[model samples]
Target chain A: MPMNEIWNRRLKKYQSMLLRYSKYILNDHFVLALLFFAGGLGLAYSNFVRNLPQKAFWWEQPILIIILFLLLHVGKLASLLEEADKIFLLPKDYQMKDYLKLALKHSTLVSCATQLICMLVLAPFILRGLQWSFGMWCTLLVVQCLLKLSCLTLVVTSAYDTNVKQFLQQFCFRLTLLIVLAVGLYLNLILSLLFSLILAVVTNYFFNKASQRHVFKWNDVVVYEKGRLMTLYRFINMFTDVPQIVGQTKRRKIFDFLLRSTSGNIYLFLYSRSFIRQSSFSGLFLRLLFLAGIIIFFSPNYLFSLLIACLFLYLIGIQLFGLYLTFEDNVFTHIYPIDESQQSFAFKKLLRKILLLAWIILNVIAVAKPLFKVEYLLIPVISLGEIYLITGIFLRNYIKKNT
Target chain B: MTLKINGLVGGYSRIPVLKDISFEVNSGQLVGLIGLNGAGKSTTINHIIGLLEPQKGNITIDDIKLKDNPKAYKGKLAYMPEMPVLYQELTLKEHLELTIMAYNLDPADTWKRANELLKTFRLDNKLDWFPANFSKGMRQKVMIVCAFMTKAQVYVIDEPFLGLDPLATRDLLNLVDTEKKRGAAILMSTHVLSTAQEYCDYFVLLHQGKIRAQGDLEELRSIFNDKQASLTDIYLGMTQDGHANE
Candidate 1:
């Protein structure tokens, strides 16, 4: 393929991947657009409100801003290509130098533009507030952008060697840039420009060296990339929702009590059995505990406590419902000679058991903690009631839809 | 005891993948389930093992209905899926240990059989290795060893030989033969009809969610006059009837 065609195809593939992977988090186009607009407004507000960097600590504000901006983008670009490095980019091992060149070119332009935008808009007000000369500030701004780009090049190029090392280096580089900008502020303009030139030369040297270092081996990179993606995927899978892998892990022998033979309903036993094996549900349970803990520590009034409790109940209901939806697609259930009505009943009973367990635990904690007012006992009671009501309605609709 | 099914209609969800599926496996009989891709062979076996619910009918193995007593019913049968289903966290020995615990097998017997299976499959060196590290063939061997170690009354295996090397496949086939001689009923699904022809005592041909034909090799061949055909030939002949006309 022609180089232009390959680059186009690569860009399309990356765009599609980003879109698909962001689906669970983004939900809809309107939400995405709103989020972007909100983010822009938030940034503008923060910049306007903060009155820019106002310290007399011998450092130019514009230079500091440029340094911080560049460092942030460097880290992002490094992590972004980390996945590509694992699967497609690093695999053509012989031509990695060429790929690194492309990556560096992309990262430099992106980092420079982002830093320039932030510094140009935010710096003048801040520099003026700090009473710096415009001519000196302009010189520092240009030099700082170069410093930022250089630091980015150094950090991102070396990321292929080790993510941990690259991440730490990016952080360390920010600190170094701050020190350099401080020195430039104290030194004469001639000395600052000379120092900036030296720093640029040194960064270029490291970037070239790091780019040639083909450190990501094939299988290792693939596994690392998979692990990284799965972490992000698992997080997104928690919110909105995705089909979580319902893998069964042998629980501790103590929890084996739950698996004990119950002569009552065979379907109930199976349903409970499957529910306990839903690994991600444990995370939701932990989230509830943390949320409850925060409410205990932080909520000031009874109404605040009640609202948080209601939110907790909503989480509980959704987790329980999600478990059913997930296991409903379970291949084992499909293959097993279970009765439809029996399976549905078992699922409901299992949900009730889990909900009851959560209710008991949360109520015990809430009532015992004196941080809660006597009226706060009403929170757990009301929360459980809300959960039961919501789950009951959802279950009725879900069953009707399935049937 | 024999596993008997009068009319087994089942599949994934309400979508019926196995329609009016019925089969019986007496103790000591080796039954091969043959089908092309998407032929409902796995669906049928899954229903028999009690992993799937029957949409319209019932299945009984060893005189115990899966719906009536899943725990007891599941204890009597061991299932091996097409892919080696394993916990990456568990070592090979731990996989066997968990299966033994699930089935409530005698500890001594479990250990002895697991060791023997490892030796037989030439995987004794890998007892401590996590399944995540195993190759595709090795993983299949682990699944085979775990199933055979259970020593269940019935074995329902789907495409058991997909990634197995020739030696491992031979060992698996021989293990199946030995299990049959010991009066254990076996239901195996595979697209490799030639291997099934050689090893299976009876054949069940599934096509498009229905049982197209089933019988002994000679009986299956008898469907076509004076044709002493192989099992694959008969299966192909039966499946092609409509296609040939079209």
Candidate 2:
């Protein structure tokens, strides 16, 4: 096939995949909008970083940024891998080489678009601090990105080929790049250019070799890709903005004691059990624990107290909402003749109790930290929030009941 | 009390799998629902169990409308899905405990019946085993034990014979007999018409998502003019007639 035709075909394939993804990743239109808004906010944040004084080393901020990107990278890879495994499109393998070439192009475009955007946003501060010209910075940034792309490509190829040598090659190249980058930053512009050129050439050589060495192992590719996608999916799910796949897992048995004394309807009993057993709900608990851990670690002073409380409550709120949605999946529930009105009511009560318990535990822990004071005012606010949540749940249930 | 479903129209999605399905099983009877693959036999059970909503009509169990009051109706019925739905995290005991909790049986009765069921189903040795390690037959037995544990007013069982050993099947049949004598209705769906023939007091032959014929063995026998003929013979004749129409 002609290059244009291949490109068109590949584009069509990607568009279809994106359409399927829109069902989960972009299932809620508001979430899609939030992702865009987050991207914009990210750009603005990056711009702000660039405007920071050159002397401001900003190690913590940059480290945090890298960690954020790492999480997102893992998530994106996981989602991609998951989709690839769903249906192998094995018939398309008749022209496997062409398809792979097109796929490599597609992967490169996506990877570069994201990395370049970040590099560009950080370019001003980075260039000024390093005493480099705009042209030099752009060149270095482009070359650095190519190296990053090559490393990613190498990982993908190695994972596909089941090649041990690629792992060694990847580790060696990354180490070399890091050493050269550190030296070049302190050295002359020409030295930096030389280093970038060397890195880029080495990256290109390895990437080309890796790409050419491909032996198609469909299941290996699918599994590796799925593993990657699931990791990212799990991370992206943490954000209120991103709609990631919420998988079911078996819940711990410690909560069964609560199920013993059942006063509510039978549906309530079943719903409560589901709430406790469902993986999605447990994930909410973990997320709250994680958020709490982070807050404790930071320990921002009293001036930022309310803001911290607001953030804590917000995170808890998201967790509670996740608990509600855990039962909403069309798995066993849809097939069972469950009374929707009763289910909703039961779910509301169950969630309210859970939220109250979680809040008390988390709040008490937070206040125990010497840096933070326990404010009586926020307790009422929190109580009111819980009440409101319960009320809203019932109201939503009524709407569903009526509809 | 009898379980009755009339004009049940529903399926997975817009593709209607079950069409105007209606059937009945009086208390103290072992009823078999037989059909070919994709014959909507399971769909009928789903409607009766209150799983799938009838786009066109309603179901009543013991004169209680399923649509009007599902929890009450559901309380009277215990369903065993085609493929057993077991909680992997839960042990066999936990599974029974959860069921007992859902059914809201008296604590004493729950424990008493649970122990009796465990012994009867030969799951006494596997009380602590997680269902993840259990074989297919064992899983089916677990589901059966859970349903039978409830000893509800009615049992809507789907494909109970799929993964059962001969002994387990015999035990299940015996259990069904016991439930029947206790005035509890049993509505079972299966493709093994012959296996069901000996136990089922009545048979409802579903073809292409509709009930073709239903009655005691004599009534079904006269319809095919195959007196002393097995249910397999009658079912084959009915389906041949159904296909000829199609």
Expressed as tens digits, the lDDT of each residue in A30-91 for candidate 1 is 25433544565667657664664455545444655555544544423323334454555544
lDDT of 1 at A64: 56
lDDT, candidates in the order shown: 0.67, 0.65
True contacts kept of each: 0.11, 0.24
User: A289-337 in candidate 2: lDDT tens per residue?
Assistant: 5655455334445323334444455455544554445435323344343
What are the TM-scores, per candidate, against the unseen true structure? 0.65, 0.73
Tell me how much of the true interface, by contacts, candidate 2 captures: 0.24
Best by TM-score: 2
Q: After superposition, how far is residue B172 of candidate 1 from its true place, in Å?
A: 3.1
Native-referenced DockQ of model 1: 0.21
